[model samples]
Target: MDKPTRLIEFESMLFTRHTIPFNARKWGAERELDRSAYVLLSRIQIDGPLSISQLSQAFGLDVSTLNRQTAAMLRAGVVERIPDPEGGVARKFSITTEGERRLDADRARSIRSLERVMADWTPDEVAQFAGFLNRFNRDIERLEGRPWPRP
Candidate 1:
């Protein structure tokens, strides 16, 4: 296939079809965080406390949308508002202990699911795919001028 065509198909499968994560939360686990919470919690866990403005800039979302998401997270008891560490005018959101636990559990579950799906693949194959994905993600982040924190 041509390059553009191949890229289009890859995007179709990865996003439109949900091939990679395959909606892991629905596969198993009785208590599951919704997609927005999972992503927000992961971001908060990585970056420490973040104001709504920071979150908006990081995700390219508007403040109103973030307000709703953060409000929902507050109600879910996954995040708490705190005085900004820098004593800025805007308060920031910090992940609660429950949020940390839930995020860890959810990531573990997703990894287990990936393991099951890749059970037949060789270690080298897995490593190569992972490298490709990381590179792809990094390139996109670079183009978008929004580098994601990695550890």
Candidate 2:
């Protein structure tokens, strides 16, 4: 049998190959969403409003890149800048109702896709898969010092 470490590496690569297309798919062909908006909305939805600086720290992205993404999100009407509820000097991005609607729709679609993929798996198997994936994500976050807020 292959070493567990080697097997995991190969499986992860295969997983990315299948899932990356969810983002890397043909652009402009689908009205669903771009990955940036989905991720940003998800982050904000989970953690509340975030300043560009806060988002940078959260995602390890530079301010300029976030500016561009947030600009697109603004034009898309998915997010709005609001005075920090905590009265911080910097403005923070908050998801609009439209953003919540879009995020919910996309998440539901993703969940349905996963359901089909795991249809044959028993409930215990699904639960175990979720537990393992969560642990894997937490370890990566711990090593990177960029823990994501979970809801």
Judging by TM-score against the true structure, name the best candidate. 2
Worst 10 residues of 2 by lDDT: 20-29
Candidate 2 lands at a TM-score of 0.91
Candidate 1: residue 111 lDDT (0-100): 84
**lDDT by residue (tens digit), candidate 2, 6-41:** 999999998877663263332212335688899999
Model 1 over residues 74-140: C-alpha lDDT tens digits?
Answer: 9989999999999899999999999888888878887887788789999999999899889988999
Q: Which stretches of candidate 2 lie over 4 Å from their true place?
A: 20-31
**Candidate 2: which pairs clash?**
none
As for model 1, its CA RMSD to the true structure in angstroms is 2.1
TM-score of 1: 0.89
CA deviation > 4 Å runs, candidate 1:
1-4, 7-16, 19-22
